[model samples]
Target: MSFLTLLRRVAMTLLFILLPAASGWACTPVFVRGQASTLRLNVGQLTVPADARPGTPLYHKSFAWNRLSDGGEQWIRCADDPHGLSPLLLDSLLSGGVTRPTVYQTNLAGIGVRVSLRAIGGYGCFPDRPTPSPFSQRVDNPAALPRCGVETGLFPPDD
Candidate 1:
């Protein structure tokens, strides 16, 4: 079967096994490999917009994928379905289509399993804007903008 198809199957199985018990937990479980660290984490229900260039992928509604490393939580936003992971994703994750997201992972949702997230293209491409700005402040730090092409390893928006 295709990767996404297989992922869906896996997600369903995981949901059947995990959600019944962990339903009360604040986050859901998701598995990952080859990341050189923890493979599983509790995925939360919270979702926010994908922080990327306005017209970029994942610029739409995005879901957060949580990972616990060194006993701390790290969040990675993801895209909606058809990318492998549709299960484990909160209802909000599948609702919106804001940013244009790059297919970063084959498994986009499917928490409580080894599914990857595709809406996760907003790494360094998203700037960290300082101060409390409105939605207009979509980009990250202005000074850090240069880092996109240099340190952060991202191409210019115009490109």
Candidate 2:
């Protein structure tokens, strides 16, 4: 039992214990009644709005995620989204970093988000929606995105 070997064992044990907790603590948005919900990310916790109302705008100035990594804080909002989706927080979870914006539909009964990516805009429950077809069968076009019965004329940037 060398001192260096003991140190290594302790480090490995710490890693094994901390890794799962780190992942479990990762920020995730909260949804209410199948509608888009907002969350606040602090040091190591995500806080969901206590008074969230259904169908209201999900993103607000105070609630928006501030990109503090850069020199100064920049507020990411829905209206000026270059990516076409608002609230910006839900982007990665919903899209899975895919080129096309992933869509989830709220159930007819409005119980929760459906498992299927059947339509765009979370079936209108989501605040943002891409425009109807102009992009067709291309890797970099609106047509590539899933089209649904309801369209908002909003589209993400090409490629």
Candidate 3:
């Protein structure tokens, strides 16, 4: 082939290789940190409606509790089927001073899988009775509490 023809082909090939990469830059994933906590469960233990195959990884921004100013709490559960966790199980934990626990789980193939539950933030109001400590004492600092953050495999069992 002629040198000019070869040069033209090389330039076209290079453009094709870089076109997709340049376009993808505009569609970057946005991750919101410290936004409202939401439950993320893996596909295991709990039965999926067979229809829920797989979906794209959800991008989270931030997490907020019910009562940020007041005494409120949030939780995250990570497990195979966090959604399947019984209310009683959660109630038992809450009774002990746990609230709004965030749950997360890894995507399991079919049978049992691993899961984790953690408290993200909490707040409490002060007592109205005659006490040495003020109501501010009743409120627990969320930042002081432990943070639960987990990285799980992507949906569809692949990235």
TM-score of each: 0.16, 0.20, 0.17
**RMSD, one per candidate, in order:** 20.9, 20.2, 22.8
Per-residue CA lDDT of model 1 for 95-139, tens digit only, reads 123442222222333111211223223433342322111112232
Candidate 3 error regions (>4 Å): 17-21, 27-31, 35-159
Better of 1 and 2 by TM-score: 2
Q: What's the CA RMSD of model 3 in angstroms?
A: 22.8
Top lDDT: which candidate number?
3
Query: What's the TM for model 2?
Result: 0.20
Q: Tens-digit lDDT track for model 2 on 1-159?
A: 999999999999999999988865543432221223333223232233556444323222221112211232222322323333223222333323445432233322211211111233443233233322222221211211232222211122233
lDDT of 3: 0.33
Runs of candidate 2 exceeding 4 Å displacement? 30-159
Candidates' C-alpha lDDT: 0.29, 0.32, 0.33
lDDT of 1 at 4: 100
* Candidate 1 global Cα RMSD: 20.9
Arranged by lDDT with the best first, the candidates are 3, 2, 1
Best by TM-score: 2
- TM-score of predicted structure 1: 0.16
- Pitting candidate 2 against candidate 3, the one with the higher TM-score is 2
